[model samples]
Target: MNLLLAAGVLAVSLLGGARQTEAADCPFDEWRTYKNTELRRTADRKAYFWITSRTAIDADGAPKAYHPDDVGKPCGATGAGLDCPSNAGYPNKSWWPTVLASDPTNPSKAFVQPSGPAKGFFVSKTALQDSANGNERDTARYVDASTIPYLVFPRPFFQLVGTGKPGDLGMAFHLETQKQTAFIVADIGPDEPLGESSIALFKALGGNNPNPRNGSGVASGKVLYLVFPRSVDQRPRKWPMTQEGIEQGAETLLDAIGGMSVLQACATLD
Candidate 1:
């Protein structure tokens, strides 16, 4: 390789390693960077990362910007309703599919696919909020973005966090706004382009006018997200996971990792 190219590669490698070493001061654990995103884990079972904030709407009635279908804008994009796009296509086809049919009637928001593997009912492509809101391929119910605070990571990250399903892990957030909230692992997205959270999580972090339908989430990298894996309760939880429960559950785990103040210090590692 050319001398300049080799030098550039070396600089990136050294910078990444140095950052990891600085972030993972704990001997028992280590840190790793991906696509310039910095994340760390402790032997005591805590995983934390500093990333940007982007809004995701994976639940029923999760529209403020673009209405994927008629769930939120049941009456059509006029009265408290978001108008359907002339072309019905969502950014990622998992949570909201490219093809959708909505009921003309209100409150009976049934989304149908003209034809597909999930033809009978509108299937959610995400991992969390199963049975309806997520992967179960049913009508959207529970896990409302207007209420629940959620975070999305890749499936591999979930495996790396180790031993937890959706809503099982406790998450904590510290935004540049200095706003913070307890969140849950509620969805899974692509492996790259990290930093995606629910609409409530966006609002929780003081994000203004959060939007998800256009695949537009906050792009500024001034947010921090930390998760405690294996912090799940012995029993699985039902849907409609409450923010109160998430906060209560996250408290002890955050304390275990030296509390939110320490996490704040971590935000400066890069």
Candidate 2:
């Protein structure tokens, strides 16, 4: 075996021994990391694993109510405006649930409709689009019937995966034979689902689903997710991430976890 891959195997072997002892006692509320854990079998016949990170849903399901006090008159005014955010009607429409800024910001200008009764968070318009090709929407961002990312087995658990706060760098890693890529938890999804990633992240991991938004490459659970909670990079303090920035961020995270050498082995795997 190559040196990097060999080192990775050794690291996993060492950590596996330690994790085995604590596996029986790990707390439910605290975050944790996992290695080489198998996910649900996929049709594509790939192996999948996961690391500890919290995920939320961002797609359509049931309708939820907004706080009356937070409700405005719609269309940026009071008293019978055009139902500004959701336009569903008075008290039925949704608003930015959390205060993103003291004064309204440009990127945070849009409003999201209630996907279901549990809906509580919102993401920027840019978060729903792709940086590399500039696709304006994603399956997770829509409430349509044909979307692939929207799951029914466990209800519609679609949302950007991140802390509601902007610039949150919570991320998940997709590992292949000798390759891996990083993705920021830029949106949220259902609370029950554990294996979801952004369309961009899915594509980066070599997913062949035709529709970037709906079809998942990791369907067979061949991908491994190494999630880093509350790990957002604070230097840029920006929303939509650049490709270069994402690559750098991935390296930074691997470094933090002492997995860089292991990842190097993965990159060179045959």
Q: Which candidate is the best by lDDT?
A: 1
lDDT of 2 by residue, 59-107 (tens): 2211221223334533332322111224222333243322111123443
Tens-digit lDDT track for model 1 on 1-270? Answer: 222233234334433444443544442244666556666666654455545543443333243223334443333314222223322333323433422334444323434444643343342333454443442323344355556677767666666535355766555344334456778776666565566667777776666545554433443335556666655553365455567777777766666666644543454454
- Give candidate 2 regions above 4 Å deviation: 1-166, 170-177, 210-219, 261-270
Per-model TM against the reference:
0.62, 0.40
> How many steric overlaps are in each model, in order?
3, 30
Candidate 2 weakest lDDT stretch, 10 residues: 145-154
Computed on alpha carbons, the lDDT of every model, listed in order, comes to: 0.50, 0.33
Task: Evaluate model 2: give its TM-score.
Answer: 0.40
